[model samples]
Target: MQGSSIAVDKIATELWAAEVIPRVKDAVVYLDDHMAEALHWNRGLAWLLDSGALAVRELSYFESGLSKAEEKAVFIVGEPLVGPCLSRIAAVVRASCFTCCTVITSCPPAAHHSALYGAVPQQELRDSFLHVEEQLLDWMGNMNFSTTVIYAPLALVSVAPNFVIMPQFQDVFPTLPAPQNTNDSCNKELGALPRHLQTSIQSLVGNLCSIMNMLNVKPDVFSLGQTSHFIGEELERCSRSSRKERGLTLVLVDRTMDMAGALTSACDSVMDRVVRVLPPFTKGHSIDVQVDMSSLCAASRSTAESGISNSVAPGCLSHRDSEIAMHHLVTAKQKECLMELNRLLVEWGSRNGLRLDVGGRLTPQLLQKRVNQFRGTSRNVLQGGLLQQVLGVARALSHPGAAKLQDQYGAEKLLLQNAVANGGSPVVQLLRSRHSMGLSLEDVIVLLTLLYSLVGEKALGDDECLLKAEIVQAVYQAAEKDELPLFLHDLLRENVHEENAVLAAVDHMFDVLPGLGSTADTPKHRLLLECSNSGTQPAVYKPLTQQLLHEILQDDPTLQLVHHAGGLTDRIKSGFGFFRAAAKPHPRDNPVIMLFIVGGVTASEAKLAFDVVSSNKINKQVIVGGTALAKPQEQLRLLFQRQFR
Candidate 1:
């Protein structure tokens, strides 16, 4: 894991030095806040900007500070879809300044082209591209500065650039690549797909090649899926000669092919607990919790005889402290930890003549004072601001409303498991009593969709069918009322007709490795039991891809290195057979394995790849990269929008 971090940092730094630093001089940098935060760009940017390479006047967020500087500037845009906005911002900034401006995006030119004209009909794609090009040229001409556009197509966290976390484009265009237009009689069928998808695929392939070049990885074998055969061919064309000694294998898979793993809710994991209680995991690992300092001060005053000091102000806690608190809150086994901390706070406040309530606000001073008071104890519960934050999160999670929602989530999970294992009646009765479950209508729909994905139409009984219909009707009514979008109706309909390939894969995975789906109390049930048992809180979830890779690489003998020209679907068939191969000795002591997920990857999955390689579990160094990092909800929402809109 440490090695992975080092590698990622090295790559990000090298890329920054090579592309960004040399071009930036006495320029105001407009940073895309979202991308910066997601990719942990601060570290690299800070090192470069602070190192005196570029005389950066000021750093500004993309939305703000565009017109603040009347000087040459560098605009780091997030993606090509935001080209218009970026152009507008640059135009506004240029109006006030006569200096040249350079626009650098984390996406390729193809992404921008795709955004502008990819959706047009194949025949009209050229005209649309030309129109967009003309508009961009006109816009640039009006600006006072000479504008240059550079495509970085690099979205990686400074801490793990080797993982190469890409954006989840498939979520937006769920039915993309338009299947294989099999109507051979029609000439148009040959080029039925929108130009954008093709360009995007090419850009992705290009990005992969760049990464390979950066890493100096020459694989002896390429195991690509049908959708990604082009990547293999490109790699083959680029390779000078194969080095079998390295024994590197590249595995590329489509997200749709593994929907069950991507969409299924994690059971009994730290991620599950955190997601159930806290806000959704969007782009980053941190979450903000609004802490009421005034209330806490008031509570402290009431509890302690010595009036609490007015030095502590009311505001949100530090992000670092809050992150620490959240980590402990999610991993904590004893709920009483929060109560104990709360009790300690009140006790200390009372001793200091400060009045406090049971659910009072927590401040740094209060925490420090408590820590000082408990210094004599062997285990300092109030060691850091973490205790205070943990108590805050606990209070929120323990709320009646939050507790009820958690129960509903658990119930939903059970329903999914039961449906998949026993083919039981759909939980219509439970869903109908919505008031009792305290679940939102959207939650119900999501759960039902999950079940639909697993069971398929043929497996669902009459009662289950009726339940599904009722849920659909409710969803439709919500859509009519604008609580839900009209597209959801189409999404639900399409979900019902989805092929059972994902389901079959899920069954096969569980059959081969029961521990994966095991709910047993054994250590095998949890992926990172070693970390947990060692009293170290894991930074991220054990990635599903890592788990799958570990299982496949451990003592698998039948699998031999082979170069195949098939797509993801074909590769999956062969891959599983290879996984099922008996354990055999390898030629090399340590081999190189390359794993790529086509649609997108989660941060947790990326971390797991690093961990596995660092642990030397398979006695091999693994290089993992993906198309993007996307949340499950985002993926589902994208699918819905694609189907309906």
Candidate 2:
């Protein structure tokens, strides 16, 4: 060990804590190649793995591949999936894009994330390598993971290097001239200092690390509260049976390992707004309308990504309306953020690359709190909490694209109908190319994968993953069996409700009709009525008739449901929601609100709103509407926004 050359310092400070997973070889079925509605990101793992690009073990612990059953059962409507693993995968890929070592001799994050797409990062142009601690904590989520994940930054302290060093008692070694050296170059200085002097040198480096920790890393994680502990606890429980006591073989490599992955593409604030509740699986006729419950709320910018518009089907109208405005907000916010990032990148992108700096306190009285947490508590924990909330919105957007925007812009195209065509980023603008993509949203798909596969199945694989996955599937599958019964399919295909039989059956949002078969819209309407009846049912978090607005109205507390057609939440319920900014000079300037109620709304009314939600007197007119007030299923889209854009 003495004669061995060591390069521990830098590696320990930089490598991603995740295991290097083998990239599954995939013959990509481009998201655009297929109708966006026909796709499910959960099946992506199967496609990638089946193609043989990625080997399970070789992938980063965070970079997981999906299983067969998980993929097969995902389409079961009421059993929608949801979790942290997917978010962590997202975080890992994002964090790896920045590289520090231009040389590929050793694996590091910048290099690793770059490797995902087969790209080489010359140097992770740093904007300030802040939040290293937060990212590490995210990778540490509970719910079963063997290997208490290690990082290259930590490994760098121990990994052997090409340079050689001499025995401490005899003589000191000299610094070798390396092409990528950022440290001060020392020319062969071999002075034999006393043991005390050597100890002092060690202390100086150690102290530097301590200072860095104080400045950049977070303090104890307990500050994040019980949920953090809950995740860790879940991980431990899930990992027990999976841990093979036998020593495992592995090597440290980060996303930069896949320079090919990032080549393609890829928050929350103002919490306490949205709310939705449901039975575990898609069970009975019971959806609780929380008279008043505080839930998380954040807006999504509408430039792109979200699949909301008039082209949507009646069933999906509510889904589209509920999301458009919020996503529109996120787009605006991120664009501003992008500008700031671009400005900073010009300055800091070269050194270490910028990390989204958050958390940490500045002075005395401000102790026990981070500046941004608002409450002044730990920011890392809240960030994780935000990830959980974002997961909800993502689960809400994945669609089959049945209501895709058509090529028709007749005398009455809805004002919000062509929303997806709008661009939020230079990259997205190029990707969208066309005006609108009538497809299921990416956010909901990713969310479902995480919820159902990773967290729901507790997919750490360190324990009895086989058993746990089977159990999860069994519970949800039983629900699916009940809903998609053969008789139900026969009824659906018989054109019982709409002109198109299959569409007619789909319109019947319920599994079993509540006595109103040919007369009622079918099971879909029955299911809508069941929303009020979904007691302590396991299907609550599961999929809904329309994955769109059901989750929002049911899950989001801020979601207001009024009997009337038009008005703002603030104007109606003082301080009701966030829209009370300032009065507009003119009524036309009022924001158009797009609201949606799930299966509760009648199919005819849904079709009407789907047709009208996007129409305008002229280009860029704002119209706000969701489920019809007269519709039996009552979660109508209220005038949440003062006026639509």
Candidate 3:
């Protein structure tokens, strides 16, 4: 279940609906204001374009020759329109089918993307941006039609009610600033951002400040991870209003600092498992996956009316429908999805005059069994077409293949937790026999990255650290001896370079996994290695995000009052004190706790925010925002500098 407050995603979509879309309509109306017979608005809703006499006559001027065509406005959303996107825009602009066209974007124009992150944008990047712009401009100028492009201050996409992402920068990692020089800095280096990234961070800070200002809420800021100091500098530049008694706390963390959280698979999460198992159907910046819904539609009994046609044709799910369905699926837990699906099937069966009973209660397993038994009869076709793929998914979860996959993930997590100090043999065997272990090169790379993040480069000299070194050496050997995947070799060549260079880059690969953990007793192998050989307590392993949430509870000054209240009698006495004192109101009666990851946040990590909020801890809303909702493969690709497909 979700929290009482609006989810981050709903807020974002509503922002577009209430702000961006309305502005586009206003612009259209403003342009038509001077016309003698302008297009009329229907019920003050700009989304519906009404073609007047003048608008219809205007269509004849074009070579399209649609004298009776009704004028419509086509609004496009997406940033930095690429070559194929530009061509599509050109076609729409040239067509007489639509009277007006507008492109609404949140990001900097395509030409500026490279410059925002790099000292100098590559020649290819500049040329590509220019080529796209030139083609669009050529088409617009030749047509002589009125087309407008509006740049909005909208970069955040709320993927769910409480989760936000900037899809454009999904692959971007904040550049590490030059380390501050100091006598004792050999062991611990301070990180800084590049000049371009400084500008980008400042811009982000400015936007955040503006939002805070608009909301009339002063914020207490906490910065952590690799880009902490850089973000702090940007925040310092912005003037803040006086702090209030009750105000929200903003936690900004760099995702790279939590390599373990980003890499680990969440077995209990249905959305996590689906994203992991299913190959994502990527189209430009959108990440989606296909799912069969033939029997699902029949069970819901709304097939024809829904108009969800795909390449599979009638009784099949469409691409757009699949995206919407998956979005809903990811927002809920695995058990919830199965329960709901089973209920729908049972209800539909009763309504359709088919008396279906799986022990008088339809469960996912029993339904799956029945579906298999009824695989190809006329009755099966009439009753529910084909078996619902989701049911098959439920069944597959208990299969040996899924069990083996879970075991592999568990082993990887355990090995990473101990920094391979608990016998690196298992890791070596996994890397050497990856094909049998159901591990890909990317998966092995993730384990290595996590291992490196935990132990870091400094520990390679220690005898215990030699175990991890051997594991790394094994990976290198595996790559050389075995046949590589189509792109794995290229990825290794471009990013890894030589074995020693890669060993050096290990520190840069992932920011040292923060020493923070669920408990002090847990052996945090990384921290102990920093000093010249001192006995430091190991950190108890837990999700970095959960640890962060607990730290927030302990650190927030406002929360301290509620958490440290003496007793019920003391509180009542204070409430009835001579000052006519009432209990201090929690800022906004439970202000939003926004945890924004600087680089990218993973779906598994996002679940932690929901957990904190759902538990009613501190009675506050916890919202997670990031550059992207990263998958393990995406994380690997980002570190290795490969084009994510």
Candidate 4:
């Protein structure tokens, strides 16, 4: 043979201070690349190269930090995870289940054997999270494999209707590869991540998916394709021969199907932040989310204006302006929401070790102004945006990913219920008031206008301008009651319309909601939010009372005897059908501000929820949350059911 060269995965490099290389007191001549290369070129020169750098990533963690290509970091699996000892010169990657600690080390021998290998399966485990196939755990308790790393993103795999048929986790583990961006929505932009970390995650997720798919039933074409274990093992052998320092990442998911953990009732808790706060159209770093309402109409008049630079609008000037105003309002609210969340984070950081950026804090006076601006902007985004035309986006997203599982009709029914329950436009509630009755023309107009404003447009109703300011003041007066979401249902219903008089609320609602829209061409979607017994969550993803509003709306919007109340005729005759008007906060209910974080949540649904929740400016709510606020199913199950199964 003429020549052959084998390249190792690891390479040593020098560290520079400013631009200068520092002198070492003591050093091992592990690598002399020139000689190594020369030896490769000529086997006769091999004796000239004495040694090379250590391949132990763990050892590198203890040595001073080196250029990324220089040091290998070790993987740790223990408490105080990534602690000072691990973080200090040694670069360490730790893999762990957030809802657990010391998985293999926690239990005693006999008990551990029974729990891990015994025939008895934990009820809660099967009910709350996904069940672990007997074969997968066999590798763990049986020690068939050493230091196995499970790689499938838990959220994806955990969502099957039945576990008895789902592929085993072990079959998915060994071939584990890193997660990849299957599409724009997957959010896995490789270049966006640090090089080393990127490869690690990709390998982890890819391997898992590959192995899992090789078994029983293959994933759907529209779904994440699985990788095989044989391929995984081959790759492993190559890596070992190359003496690669393999680090690991383990992602745990619990929510599988939308039905079992219906996330629909989370409008106040989740969705609003996404539409208004996240603004998918936006790009780059700064929150320069300025949208000129006047330009919106121009975009629609001419297709040239509808391009990316224009952002939105493809119709009449007024409609365009309306949409633009919606964007402007949403942007304004995001800043304010950011301010509010920053305040909470700062306090939390003070209590803990996290020191949030000082600039994010809002003073008491500025806070008041920010709140007003945010609420005003939110009102616009809700009323003018595409979602406003297509009603129930809030209800749909609030339950993250629920709309996907159900058929269109099923989805519509769910949304209709949600609209009604949230004290939907007067039209919906009115129609719902009497099972056989329908809304009058005037009622429909008012209802549509209300729905528009609720999405993100300027409301033309009683809560406008100074009236709104007064209502806000009144809300503060009875702040305690506002948090009691149940009491706010009537207010949410009546004021939603009353808040926007000029917009012809009911018609606008039809324009936006899927079933009510003018065209069959518009793809229809509905939400079927359900939580299964196995999703190891401690409580509902949101407050129980918040969810009840949609239930109430879908049930009945009338109190019969009264002209508007949703009950019977006798009560209406006695003014029972009428509800007391209280645009301003009263002692029974006050406006509330909430904070949500979805940092731990893995699904795009969770990230989108964060974006939606961060944009709310509703009368009774000033909530903020996103990916960071999402509580994992495991955490919920632990808190709700001891998470022991």
Best by lDDT: 3
Task: List all candidate RMSDs to the true structure.
Answer: 11.3, 29.8, 11.4, 27.1
Candidate 4: tens digits of C-alpha lDDT, residues 480-504? 3343122222223345324343123
Q: Which ten-residue region of model 2 has the weakest summed lDDT?
A: 72-81
lDDT of 2 by residue, 3-84 (tens): 2212222232222112111211221111111111111111222333454432222212343224322111000010000122
TM-score winner, 3 or 4: 3
Sort all candidates by TM-score, best to worst.
3, 1, 4, 2
Q: What are the lDDT scores of the predictions, listed in order? A: 0.45, 0.22, 0.47, 0.25
lDDT of 1: 0.45
Candidate 1 lDDT, 193-259, residue by residue in tens: 4454555554555455555566555544343233445445545444434333333456665444334
Residue-wise lDDT of candidate 3 within 41-129, one digit each (tens)? 01122232332222212111222324324343433333345334444455555554444555554433322453334332322232334
lDDT of 4 at 408: 23
Residue 532 CA error for candidate 4 (Å)? 37
Question: CA lDDT of 409 in candidate 4?
Answer: 22
